[model samples]
Target: MTKLMIVEDDEKIRDELRLFFERYGYVVACATQFDHVVDEVLSAKPDILLLDINLPYYDGFYICRSIRKQSKMGIIIVTSRNAEMDELMSMNLGADDFVTKPFNTQILLARVASLAGRVRQDGVQTSVLNYGNFSLDANKMLLICGERSCELSKNEYRIAACLLRERGKIVTREQLMDDLWNNHQFLDDNTLTVNVNRLRRKMSEIHAEPSIQTKRGVGYRL
Candidate 1:
């Protein structure tokens, strides 16, 4: 079943959304705490996130940016802030879509369904990827090797996922950066190198076999 997470502070609206989405057959999870909204959403590992802009501790923009750093989960900003700049900022922070306040529940449902469909089309709906002895848990951001396991950060998980998808084939640096940042023009090459190094360290800690191999100027291989 497709999972949905809601991060709205308004109790009445949150309950309404949860109930409405559940009626549509979605396994819904609601945020009970506002200060750790990002962690809450990540833990839920929902297929789609319905986020509100005016959160309690941190705004939705901050939450969106934090979530984008680790996962490419679909995020739709459902907020009362209807200004054009607000929408633009939400998109800039990696929100998949934006819906204004007083939104029609049906419309919200349609948007969630559309975003979830896009995620499926991207071939990321699966929660796990198995490569040889390694099992990458997309939901938990964990890489398991036999009995030992190591948790991965969002960037590390993406890098591992990309490499594992192609297995022994070479994955160029440019391809990795594009995959990680969604072709953000301002991204630095060093960031990709750092993430790859971190991933290598994690894999090593678990003694994962068929280690990530650097192909010098060409790219990396597993």
Candidate 2:
């Protein structure tokens, strides 16, 4: 069974979460020591973390950053902070997913399952999708060519994979957004653009060629 850690301060809500996940066959654990959350998480070594932003000693953002520096465990922010900035900040800080409070548990479960399926031990995925010299290893979220390599974030990886797969073929914005949404990314048009731009920058950083090209009023292609 997957081990799930809940880093929420509210006892009532925390209990509710534990019960819900327990019903779904997860080995759930709660962080009682708010001040030592980082150490507790490191010790427990849960497969996934349900984090709340408003914490006692250290907030979710701090704990997220701290844990990310040490582990690759998936993190999903489950908090009442609904601002776009909060979601963006959480992702920027290495959270794999973000869900606001009053969330549908079923949807949250789906996200957790999806992330769980992607994560594995180090060097687990050896397969790579290639285009001439450039290649993408979905497992590591890495884009590589020769000796140069650049790590990709979740959204950036999705966008790059799509474009790389359809390298010479044009992909519309609607198509890209729909694929990301289907994958539990929940990205908007503007957000897709931002992700694409970031992907381009990462590709440039490694000097991987056959850059993703804009299709004027249509869409984008490699």
Candidate 3:
């Protein structure tokens, strides 16, 4: 079972998340106390952390930076602050994922499971997927080709995995969005394009930049 720590300040939302994750068989813990949260979290040693930006005592960014420095535990920012700066700051501070408030818990659960499932308690590589000349280590979120390698963000990893899964086939935009951004309901095309382009740049580091080819009006192919 994956141990998850909830750091929300909202009593109702915190309880809601606790009940929801518990029903799914997760070992859930909530940071009910605002003070000394860092020490408590370090001691509890949960596998994943659901952090909120508007925390008492200290904010989520501070907690995220503090925890990341001491532990490699997965950190997902669950906050009401949906600004682009907030998201960028969260990622910059070493958060593994970010989800704004008013989000569907189901989608949040999926994201948690997807990230935590990659590495076990022992921190070993869980799986490596190979397609043509390149290999993607899902556990490490790394794309490799020949002697070069590049680390991928969660979304980029998903995009790469989907593309490589359908190597020769053209994966339509809708299909990619469904598999990659199902949580977003309908992700903007420009956002998807931005992500795809970013993935391409990362893949380029491994000399596999051309592996992901755009399909004019369709979607993408690997």
Candidate 4:
């Protein structure tokens, strides 16, 4: 089920939205504590946020910035203030969409559906991985160093994707095993080691500075 958080202060509007969306088969939550919007958001870990620009203490923009810092969750500004500047500012603050007050509930729901679908669909359409003068296409798993293109194997690509997603953070071997094999039988340690070595060799060809780094007993990072 898609989880949604409504961060508006008006009790009537909040309850209305909660009931309406819930009727449409969505798991809906409304914010009761205005002061702890960020805390509520993190705790809920909602898939999409319906936020109001005007609020007590900090406004939606502040909450939006805070959310972006920690997560890539979808944000939609559903506010009474409908100025062009407001829309632009909301986008700048990382909102996925904007819906003015007195909106058609059907249209708003449709927009939410479309945005959610896009977010889910975008997981595989990887952007180019660029570090220094080297770059690689993550979805196609093609590495480019200057004019050179290096091909990566299936296992190599999976490992690279995992490392690239975490980037500078350590990705434990257990995590890699889960990612590569789901919940299937355990893969041989030698198999993983061989794939990592192959990945490193390909990365070297692309002049990937630092390539993949091993943290001894910890894991790997890039």
Using lDDT, rank the candidates from best to worst: 2, 1, 3, 4
**Model 3 regions more than 4 Å off:** 119-222
lDDT of each residue in 73-172, candidate 3, tens digit only? 8899999899999999999999999999899976786677666655333354335555445667776889887688888888788888777556557899
Error of 3 at 53 (Å): 0.6
Best by TM-score: 3
Task: Tell me model 1's lDDT, rounded to 2 decimals.
Answer: 0.82
User: lDDT per residue, candidate 1, 1-222, as tens digits?
Assistant: 568899999999999999888765577899978987888888878888899988889999999999988888888999999999999999999999999989998667667755654564233675665554567777898998878999887788888888866665799998887887773433368888888899998888998877899999988998
Q: List the residue pairs that clash in candidate 1.
A: none
Candidate 4: Cα lDDT at 102: 90
Global fold similarity of model 3 (TM-score):
0.57
Model 2 Cα lDDT, one tens digit per residue, 37-153: 899998998888999999998899999999998888889999999999999999999999999989887667667755655554232422355553477877688998778998999
Tens-digit lDDT track of model 4 for 1-222: 466889999999999999878765567888888888898897897777899989998899999989877767779999999899999999998999999999898777766655554443223322454433455566677876667778887777777767755655789987887888963534567788888888888878767665789888777987
The TM-scores, one per candidate, come to 0.56, 0.56, 0.57, 0.55
Assess the local accuracy of residue 185 in candidate 2 as a C-alpha lDDT between 0 and 100: 93
Worst 10 residues of 4 by lDDT: 117-126
Model 4: lDDT equals 0.76
lDDT per model, in order? 0.82, 0.82, 0.81, 0.76
Error of 4 at 212 (Å): 49
The residue pairs found clashing in candidate 3 are none
RMSD of each: 13.4, 13.7, 12.9, 16.2
